[model samples]
Target chain A: MTEAATTRRSRITPEREAELYEAVLDLLREVGYEALTMDAVAARTRSSKATLYRQWGSKPELIAKALRHNKPTSLDEIDTGSLRGDIHAMMARSDDCQMDRDAALMRGLFHAIHGNAELHQALRQLLIEPELDHLNTLLRRAVDRGEVAADNPALDFVIHMLVGGFVARDLIEDRTVDREFLTSYIDAVILPALGI
Target chain B: MTEAATTRRSRITPEREAELYEAVLDLLREVGYEALTMDAVAARTRSSKATLYRQWGSKPELIAKALRHNKPTSLDEIDTGSLRGDIHAMMARSDDCQMDRDAALMRGLFHAIHGNAELHQALRQLLIEPELDHLNTLLRRAVDRGEVAADNPALDFVIHMLVGGFVARDLIEDRTVDREFLTSYIDAVILPALGI
Candidate 1:
């Protein structure tokens, strides 16, 4: 409704968009998805509702973009010549995974994501798949280097255990998943399970 | 509010309460937590809102109780002597860890649990901690039986691996955590990590 007939659009600079995404994630951490509204987003970003809608179409798309923005791109860059080294590096990346903000963001998404098909698919596709793919690539390299058995059945779910440990640590155990904990986890649980 | 003037209340039998819990879990699976309401529960159970309010006092308590009621109590009774047998039995218990209903309940609770202090506390106190205690007891027995090292560092996070594996199986991996899969998990990942 902001523009019914005009095809021309004012281009938003990447810097502007980045600021907007940050505002969205902050609001997501504060209010969560069920309570998150486009009006609130527009107000926080100091932008028009029509502009927001035109850019993202819906709340799920906006939230998904925010999550994608926050995700670290170090997966492809992780190379330490050994599977053990790669795992330690991957687990130690200083992303918001261990931060309170990321935990809040995850908790915000938990309940609303169940019946929300668009949100579920968006999260799996954007956030979950890339991490899994990276793990697969790492394992493949290990196999190539003859460091691991190619047909080890544990290889299939090894990523899930690591990922879920971090995911459930707080929610289930009320324990903080810090770097020290993850490094110990890598040495004790992960490498041993991987047949080191 | 339904009966501010009435001081007298009718006591529902344990059987009726179980039926109501079943109804709550079913509605949770169907409509999820946000869309689920006391009215929907009342209608589903053919009961009055006042009755539910009197029983659990709130939605979170009701959900927490339902989870507790559904939990497998055989954890205390599972004594296969060896730690490996105990873990295998624990993992393979057929409470439908893969069933869509339980998954839906988990999904439904994911986002709603955060920022909801009442619900969060209810889940931890009523559901999560009991399971953790059961695992602890099982491990303690194993330690005394000399089946596992008393000072093994891996014993600390071993529960996390088993738990995180099941929790993330469907959501993260899209694979079923079946008996055969868990059996292999016990052999390949669990035993090796535990040095069993």
Candidate 2:
């Protein structure tokens, strides 16, 4: 291996990367994106700053990757016979506490994403696009089943609606996003829009 | 007038309060909620720090009151014979540039709101609840007109959907929240979900 490759391989094993990412997410939850620092992450993980810089490049990129790493399952792995069943099955994967924590993490990230263009680009490319592709796959299956029409404009905004439901709940009602709420939202708002 | 009234009248006239709130909003846009301080507002408006404290009580209250003052027209005054007309008129009240500025301001506030309880309470009490009350009036009109069922679950979530549209546009699509996008979203996602 080249010297650069040798250094990278020595520094970041799969387990080590996972440990670092967990530290990053814990710091993210504690202090949020604005207050979090590379120095903090390095100290938390007992790694050098140079190692983190070599591994992740920058704070935004690190946070973006950490968030991506935090997802419990790939949306692609979820497959149920019906679109409604698929959506509910997806929601069922996480318990209430996990959903609450993930919602809180996302709330902070949304603001950071707005302010930082690099973070926004990294998240869209690394995290968002992949999930969207997975969601589109689900939608494609639904369309093929003739559950939703091909010309439905609501298909274009499924992510927005889902994300919106997650976000607007706290802002408007000061409520924790839970499976009950998501299930109700999916049925009332999402399904109706899709003409299901 | 009592001594307290005299002191208050001397420090702040109606016009002076408007000037201070305008300065506060300008600073909020430039620096965001966390960076904005009473000292900064006092400096910008040429008011005493003591006077500001006595008037607004806290930063959250000041920011919330300023946001309330920034509204162009009350939602209650926005009756246009039909719900669709009222919604469109509300959209038309602000031009594209103003909408862009407001949406960006809101995006920053959403993050701050998630973290700050006092700010959230002030905003809900001073800004959000009043708007929701007005929106409820609009929905009530629709229900009375036989346009929508009062029991529809989506009725409870119109604000969520609207707020989500404003927020999710930037995060997901990386697009500016414009009239065209909102119009399409309303027609496709919101209206259909409402069974309108």
Candidate 3:
């Protein structure tokens, strides 16, 4: 490998990158996007500021990269032979992770994303679209299987249902989107709404 | 009336308060919470910074007071004697107002609320709680009339459905929570989820 490639590879192994992302996510949770600094991330992760800047260039980009890397695999693992099965499995799998911290991170980023175009675009591109696309794929499969009507109006708002609980949890109740909450949500809200 | 009461009443009439609130909301939309200034509000409303400061004491109090004063009446009017009608009526009435900028104002306050405990508490108490309480009241009335089951599981999450649309609208689709969207949401996801 070229000297630059060699340095880059040796500098940030996949495990080290994951550690750095975790530190970034932790900082993001502790301090919001506007207050989170690259220097802080580097210090917290015991890395050089030069290395962080060389890797991500800016705070927003670095934060986005961190979120992108930390995304749960449940988004990509929803194909369980049926819509109900897929949703239940996804919700179940998603429940197996630490969600409150994730919700807080997403909440922390909310205010920053509104005013920053580049950060907004990066967040959308990196974190939101893939999960949304996965839901759409599952819905399409349901339609094809006659489990859900192809012209169902509810399809348009399923993302709202799936994602809304997280956004409104703080506003509605002082609770996390825990397994119990998700299970009640799927059975009461998602399944019945799906009419399956 | 006493001299102080007479002077206060004459100086800050109900109409004057509404005008000041309007100016604050407008400035909040333009510059957001961090950048918005008492000086700008004073200038926009043709008042003095001293007057603004003497009245509100701080930016959060000013914005919170502005929001409290400008809150729509739809929250109180969702008593149409039927669950579906009440929801549709509430949705329709909420739609009748200038929603986009209201949503924008809410968005602008998002970041500030997360960081400022005083602001978050004020927002939830002054604005969110009253409206949410109204929703709860409507649901209770529906249950009393047997339009909904008192023990329905979806009851816990109806807030998530109604409020989630606004929270996730921009995040899910590059759109505002408009009338048609609310109408479709009510018909498609909400009513069905409620088993109505």
Model 1: per-residue lDDT, tens digit, B124-151? Answer: 7644676788788888998898877888
Listed in order, the DockQ scores are 0.49, 0.61, 0.52
lDDT of 2 by residue, B1-196 (tens): 4687456557677787788788887887666676577899989998888888887778887887787666544554887887777667666666778777776666556668867787777667655687688778888998899888878888888887887787778888888888988888888888789897
Interface C-alpha RMSD after superposing true interface residues, each candidate, one decimal: 2.3, 1.6, 1.9
Highest lDDT: give the candidate number: 2
Task: Note the Cα lDDT for every prediction shown.
Answer: 0.73, 0.78, 0.75
* Angstrom error at residue B98, model 2: 2.6
**Which residues of candidate 2, in runs, are more than 4 Å off?**
A1-17, A37-58, A61-65, A68-72, A125-127, B1-17, B35-72, B125-127
Q: Which one wins by DockQ: 2 or 3?
A: 2
Candidate 1 — which residues are off by over 4 angstroms?
A1-14, A46-55, A68-72, A95-100, A111-117, B1-16, B46-57, B61-72, B95-100
- Global local distance difference test of model 3: 0.75
- Supply candidate 3's per-residue lDDT for A78: 59
State the lDDT of candidate 3 residue by residue for B118-177, as single tens digits: 767766775577777777888899999998888888888888887778877877576678
